[model samples]
Target chain A: MRDSCSRELTCIARSDPRIIILSGDIGNHMFDGFKAEFPDRFYNCGVAEANMISVAAGLALSGYRPFVYTFAAFDLTRCYEQVRIDVCFQNLPVVIIGLGGGLTYAPLGPTHYICEDISILRCLPNMTIVCPADQAEVMASLRSSLDHHGPMYIRINKKNEPCIYTGEPDFSLGRAQLIQDGNDVCIITTGVLLSEVIRAARILEERNISACVVHFHTIKPVDEIMLREVFSRFSVVVSVEEHTLPGGLGGMIAEWMIDNRIKSSDLIRIGTGDYFLTHCLSQKEARDHFGISADLIAGKIADGLNK
Target chain B: MALAAKISGNKYRSFVLMSDGECNEGTVWEAVLLAPVQKLGNLIFIVDNNGWQATGRCDDIMHLNPLADKFKTFGWNSFEVDGHNFEELLNIFHSIPVDSEKPTAIIAHTVKGKGVSFMEGDNNWHYRIPTADDVTRAKAELGLE
Candidate 1:
């Protein structure tokens, strides 16, 4: 994701000289290409998230679109006040790329866990949140965020996940993609978990229960119109995410359902329960333990319909 | 001021910042120094330090003790005045021959949330958007009727 961001930035800078890249001592192996391509435009702020964010705001005021990249926790929460006042209050076009989304740094321990990044960032006004499902989605998201106005937070995973899309798909800011169509259930997924939703759909197919998969890359400014269209067809909706339930994809979907006065649908949210992860575990193992895996999702749907 | 700017070409320019503690980053500090060095005599630096920094007390971070003394050392004409007194602020503003002289610094001592009950002199009020009820009581107390 970091490499992809760097490449996208390089392309943007070639056309727009005002594009600046600011890093907080991270992205060494990633941003070398950007530095080589545009030395004057890239800056290494050196482990100071606060200074980096403020500098980006200042650069924006000077008529430059700055992209600040760092770890998810520091990039969003550490300099939150700076982001709120310096960037968002001024409504600058600063793309904050947060690497290591959710529990991607599992073995690295709780200090690196960014479960609350989405919730904390959601409270800020005029800040768009983008969670790309895979490399393909992230590439499209990077382009979309750069083109969009105002502040944006793009949360990406550290490790390289499989490419979700074979052919290049057109990406819009607030649109949700329907990966699969089902009459019985619609499974909404965000981030890398969308890959799991595909697996879950296949598992449910064997049980004769069709589960539709909707990949919601953009969380804020949600596509209520698209959701209403999908909700019209399916009776039971299951939302999946790698982060905590509250303020994640599930909570957003549920809120949209309530706000639009659309009721009588059994909404099942599959995500990390309100507890900190104990030990280092792979993404698959963590999801299974938390009952957010494909088979578990299939089982939960069967039980919900039976009851 | 224009003569000094002409000598340096177009590397930098200066603007008078009517600012408070809300903006205290290095760029702002750099801006403060640039005015005098660039001979931007029209530059006026006002620090409305209501004795508040976000999180906790300002002194805990680093004692900006004798804040006025720092500006004097920076070769700017400095003044300390009571911020709430409209006449005093106006008098100080009138006193500065800013058109000909060097840059000026006005350190105004005042409360954080001025002229309000429950919020005045509080650091927490810096970021807290007043609730509707609080706004009502405040307007009423200030005789907004």
Candidate 2:
């Protein structure tokens, strides 16, 4: 995902001279190609995420489309206040890239694990949140977000996750993708969890249960039109993501359903329950423990529907 | 600083007005440190070093003593001025440092609640809202007829 971002950003910078990239002193040589070519445009902000965000806002307001990049831990938690006041409140066109989103940094312990960035950023007005499902979606999202005239948060896993989409998606800002059609149940997924949810859908298929797999890459300003269609088509709804239960894709969908008066017999949300993970586990291990893995999701959904 | 460079160059410069407590934030240091790297000659930071923070003295809150020297070390051309002296402020702002390699920091040494006799140097005034009588006394002291 980080590679996709770098590739797309370099592509964008080639055409648009106003595009600038700022980092919080991480990503040692990930941007070597970009730096060698556009030295003036790339700035290493040296572990000061808050300052980098403010400076990005300042740069954005000055007719430059500034993208602030950093570890997910610092990007969301450390510079949240700066993002809220300087970037979001001002409604500037600053692209915030939070790499290693969710449990991707699980090896580094819970300190680096980010599960609530989506919920935290959603509270800020004029904020666009995009958690791409795969590499293709990442490039498409970066292209779409470049022209978006407001603040955008792109949550991406670090490297080598499952690719859910084969080709470049149409990738509008606030749209959802229907991966499969079904009648028994609907499975909605966000971020890297789309891989798990897709597998879960296939598992349900073998059991004579038709499960619809929908990819909700753009969680904020969600594709309500698509969501409405899904609610009417399926009886039991399940939303999954490698994030927390509250203030995430599942939480937003639940709120929207209640507000729109769409009632489902059963609504299941598969995510990290509201608790801090203390153990130092690998990404796969953490997800498996938290019931966010493909097998766990399949079993949970199958059991719920059979009940 | 980049904003200043992009929009109007040296013609329309930018200024940041911050309090002494703001110096405690790592963001301020980061920004100050980066300004030189960009060589933002049109940017200036006016630090209101009033010697007091919310609960205690500025010394107790953070290690911001000799603020000018700290800014200088961080690549900014630093200056100290009596904040109450309007002429001194005007003179300093009128001239940029000959060392045009970086941005400038003006540490304005000020008394808290300036011109308010009772509130001057009193830490309580930081949080206390001035009452009607206090306002009247303040106005009378300043002869705001």
Looking at model 1 chain A, report the run of 10 residues with the lowest lDDT sum: A23-32
Model 1 residue A6 lDDT score: 76
User: What CA root-mean-square deviation does each model show from the true structure?
Assistant: 17.3, 17.8
* lDDT score at residue A55, model 1, on the 0-100 scale: 92
lDDT for each of the candidates? 0.77, 0.85
DockQ of each: 0.02, 0.03
Tens-digit lDDT track for model 1 on B12-60? 3243544343333445556667767866666667777676664444544
> Clashes in each model (backbone N, CA, C under 3 Å)?
0, 0
Candidate 2 per-residue lDDT, tens place, B38-62, comes to 8777789999989876546767545
- Report clash pairs, candidate 2: none
Best-fitting candidate, scored by lDDT: 2
lDDT of 2 at A63: 96
TM-score of each: 0.67, 0.69
